[model samples]
Structure formats: structure tokens, C-alpha cells
Target: MGLTQTQKAMVEKARAAGGSGQAIPLSDDACVCLIGIIARDLGLSDHFPELPSDLPPFFDQREPGSLNISGVEFLPLMERLVKLNPDSDTFFSCLANLHKRRLKYERILQTQPIPTIEQVGPRGLLQFGTISATTLTGLLFWRKWFFDIDNRAGQETGYLFEPIIAHAIGGVPFSAKASPVRRAGDSRKGRQVDCIRQQKAYEFKIRVTIASSGQGRWQEELDFPVDCRQSRYTPVLVVLDATPNPKLDQLEAAFLRQQGEVYKGESAWEHLESVAGPTMGLFLEKYVRDPIQALLNKVSDCLPEFVARMDKDGITLSVAGESMLIRRTLGAADDEVQELPDDASDQIPGP
Candidate 1:
């Protein structure tokens, strides 16, 4: 967004040395200047819309007449006014990713999920139900419906979370140029890395708790660290959930065998924030974590006792004698979710 402490220090150093707002030298290898250029095209920065263009006023150049990036061939990917930050906390931020993540949460709220009632089977209820059979049955239905939406949200979040965190820490989602171990008749390419910062290929996961992932998928997971090694990068595994699982153990063992680094739970968050620096860390907490926690709290308090009656069109969910018909389509604007354009931008209009 703006600048990291290290970047600020770089600016101060330049200013004190009569560098003014001038060009910094670009290198062949990954450096702060190149990193900043890559980081500029990302989200989770404090200065999203009203980006401070003047602060990070140093650009990367090879000669007085040549405007250059690390790879001369890829110079076009670098934009004008994209500045150098020693800490890789680029100059500007895009609201695109933040908007996309927010949209996933909004879709979860608007969606009126209705699982098949037949899923309950002949028993039509839980065996442990001692009182209020109807309420318990309704609760089970709600749980199933909620589960569908929750899983959908999780998958969508997976698609968004990588870049949001990756860019915040000045990394890019990487795809290995070549496959390390190609399968027979498989058209698949190299491993899709969550984030690649310099030579560190980071694999980010919320948690790995499945008892056994499918054999093919599990093997692919195991191959990730190997692919990173073959690509000449150090593997960094970041699992946000530390809950012990046999599957996670196996996958982690695979990484460790490849001399990879692993961080779990609090350590993972700390590692992300440590690289992301104070400003981007605070931005992530405020925009990403806080909103998610608030939504979880809101859902848990209400859904724990929710009663759903499903029919052909939709389902009627009742709580405390209040009923609302929910269809598969998006619901009416409520206190929680407001109507927003599909192309949500930095300038969100007041409702």
C-alpha cells in the first residue's frame, strides 16, 4: 500500500543522501525493487484506494535512459510509478481481491441452501433426540443446508486466500515451469504453488484434517515439495490449523524430508505477519480476519437453534416465532449484506 518500515528507512536514507525522488538500480536477481513491482498488483494493503503515490517515489532503472525491471523481457509487466520498497510493501493496492473475498462471504449469506429432505432417511431424525423432535429434525436439516453453503464458501475462500496473503507479503502465486514427476497419460503440468517469495515456494493451507485424501490427490500433495526442490526453491509449508491429523502428518513428513520449512497455527500467522510487516498485518487483521470472525460469531449464535422447513420452491427458516422464506436465489438486502455491483472496486458507494 504505502511503505514498510524498511522501505521507509530506504526512503529516508535516500532523502538524507540527496537522492530526492529518483531511480534506484535494478538487479538481475530478486530484489526489493523487483519485489515491489510484483507486490503492486495485489490486495491487503492499508492504502487501497487512496494510494500514496508520492511517498514511494523511487523506481527501478538500469541506466539514465533505460527504464528496466529484473528481466528485460518481462519489463512490460512492470508498470510506471511502481516504486521500490526494501521490505517489498509496494506503493499501491488494488481492491479487487478484497472485493472478491467479500463477495464470497456475501454469497454465503444470500444463498438459501436446501439439501434433500430424503437425506434424513427412514429414521427422519437423530437417535439422541430426547425432546422436541420437530425442532431437532429442523436442526438437522439446517445443519445439512448450512454445511453445503459453508463448504462452497470454503472452496471459494481457498481460491482467494492465497493471493490475498501472498501479495500482502510481497509474493506471487507460482506455477512451476516444468513438471517434476509426470504421471502416465496425465496432461497435468507442474505444481501450483500458493506463493513464491524469492526462492521460497510457500504452500499455504487452512488445515489438513481429512483422514485420507484420495490417493492421486495425496500423491500430488506429496509431489509439491519435490516440485519446489526441482524448481530450485526452498519449500515453506504454512498450515493455519494445528489440529493433529494423520494425513497432515504424512504430508508434513514429505515436506520435511525435502528439507522444507513448516509453520502451524499461531506460528503460521506470525510468519505471514512477520513478512507482511506492521501496516499490511494490521490491514489484513482489520479487513480479512475481523470480518470473518464476526461472520462466524453471527452465524453460530443464530444457526445453533435454527429451524428449517423445506418445500418445493425453497425453505422456511424460523427462529423465535419469526419465519422467513428463503429461495435458491439471492435474498433481499439485509442488515448484514448490502447490494453491491459485481465489479466491486476501491470506491464502495454508501447505501
Candidate 2:
């Protein structure tokens, strides 16, 4: 097939690196075919069935029964492929293979005597040590989950932190009401809280664009709930913004500039502390400590009733107790097992 401009450039680069008199075991024609296969697999091209007439003469020349390329040559080609098609499934698959290779390489290294700082050079040792420490800390897993596309459904409704908090707490205790309730003799209807746990109200806001007055627009939205005296529920406000504002500064600063404040305006922050609550930072810390176990805890608490309902519909609860098994398998003995109210549903509000 006709090489795309990118593929042609990649070929030229490889030839330039190979230089004159460099005997590459793989024929240029074979390399082109391999590139075509890779491109098709990555969904980069659909014209792989037929070879194009306009291919460079280098690709046309061939005296090959089998193709071979050294690891040095293959590495550059793979790097180029990854750079060009990062989001492609083929690229991810290749990445996964590379990870496997890395694990194998680590195993080989482990068999040898551990190198001293002087032998490996202090900078090299420091880099390896930092990576090792980070991997052990489980930060990367949480970072991946935070940025994963599938988990971004909550962003649209300004409740992006709800799911993570809910999972950490083991279940969602309240559903978002479509309309706010206006009680008798009230000046305005009470603004709806995002979600409630144990009758304690929570509001989630994202301050991406600040208003002209150097304050978040959501700050205005908080006035009703924060000032609602008639309501029995204690309110808490969670804001996701990076700017320095008095409201956020007064609140407990979460990692990455996120902030959480228990509605201390009319009620004490301590009022909601006893009722299934954590500052946004603490909740995130727990989540980062172990997300799989956190999620499994949520599933364990919520899945029983779901399994029962499935049984009524003639569907089997095949995965019963698996969440607990996962927790045990992962050696998560230190995790606090939360038992949510059986009647509380774990479903979060959809965007």
C-alpha cells in the first residue's frame, strides 16, 4: 500500500540512521509490509489490502526470505509508532508488551547482585529509587483512575468528586433531587444539595471560570444551602478549583488545590464529622491508599441486594463474596470496612 506521509518520513529517518554499508537483515520491502500491518492494526489506514504503485524505490527492492531487525533498530521504530498513535489500541497493546519486557528485564537484574550508588552512578540510583518508591506508594494507580475517560461522567453535572467519595465511604446515601423544596414561610426554595449521607447534606462545585468579582459563580449558589436555618441537615461544601479565594482558603485544602469546607457559616463543621464524613483531602487520601479495595468494599456493601434482585429476575449472583475475596487476596487487612445503611443505594447521579 502507498505509504502515508508519516510512514514515508519514518522510513527515511530509519534509512538515515542505518547509513551506507549498514547491512540491515530486514529488507526494505518487508519493513514496509510490517509498517502497513502495524498501521492497519492501529486503525491508521484502511488501504492495506492493495500495494500502491507510488511507493519509494527503497521499499520496492527486496531479496528476503525472512525479515530480521536488531533490538536497537526495532526500538526507534516502536518509539515512532507510539508517538504517532498513542491512543490507538494497537499502541496500547504494544505498550503492554513493552511493560512485560520491562518486568522480565527487572527479573534479570534482580538475579545479579544489587549495584551500589557508586557503581550505577548516584543520579541513576536516585532515578531508579524514586520510581521504585513511587510504584510502592500506589499513587500511579489513583492518578490513572482519576484521569481515566470512563470516570469523567460526573464532570458535566459538577459532581466529579462524588463517585470517588461515595466509593470511599462504601455507598451513596442519597439521590440528587431534581427540584429544591420550598417550605412554608420560606423566602425562597431551599437549593438542592448534590448528595446526602446520613441526612447530612453535601454540595459539589467546580470553579473552572471565575466571575468578574474574583469569586466562583458557585459561591452564589452556596448561599441558600449554607444559610438554610429551617433544614435539620448539616451542610458541607466541596469545591474543585485551583484559584486562591477566601472561601477555599478557609476550607481544608485537598491535594492539587481542591478544597472542602463543612458549612460552618450557620452550623459547626463538627456537626457532620460523626455522620459518615471526611474532608475531601482525607477522602482522596484513603482512595489513593487503595482504590481497588475501596471499590470492592462499596461493591460488597451494595451488591448483595442487587444480587437478590437479579435472582428474582432469574439471573444468578455468580460473583457473590468476590469483593471480599479480592480484599483478602490483596492483603488489605488495615482498611476500615464500612457498613452503609442497607436501604441506601450506591448509584451516583448520572450526568
lDDT of 1 by residue, 1-351 (tens): 444455444333322212111212223222323323334433323323232322231222122112123333222222222343332223223222333334334445446444555875444544545757776666667777677666656644554566567766767664343323222234365555677787898888867877545887788888877777766788899987677888888889988988999998778878888887876675455555565456544554334555667677766778767777644564432222222212221121111
Model 1 TM-score? Answer: 0.50
lDDT of each candidate versus the true structure: 0.52, 0.35
Cα RMSD, model 1: 15.6
As for candidate 1, its clashing pairs are none
Q: What is the lDDT of residue 325 in candidate 1?
A: 62
> What are the runs in model 1 whose C-alpha is more than 4 Å off?
1-96, 104-151, 175-188, 288-303, 309-351
lDDT of model 2, residue 56: 30
Q: Give the winner by TM-score.
A: 1
- Mind giving the per-residue lDDT tens digits that candidate 2 earns over 251-296? 3332112223443321322232333344322333332223433453
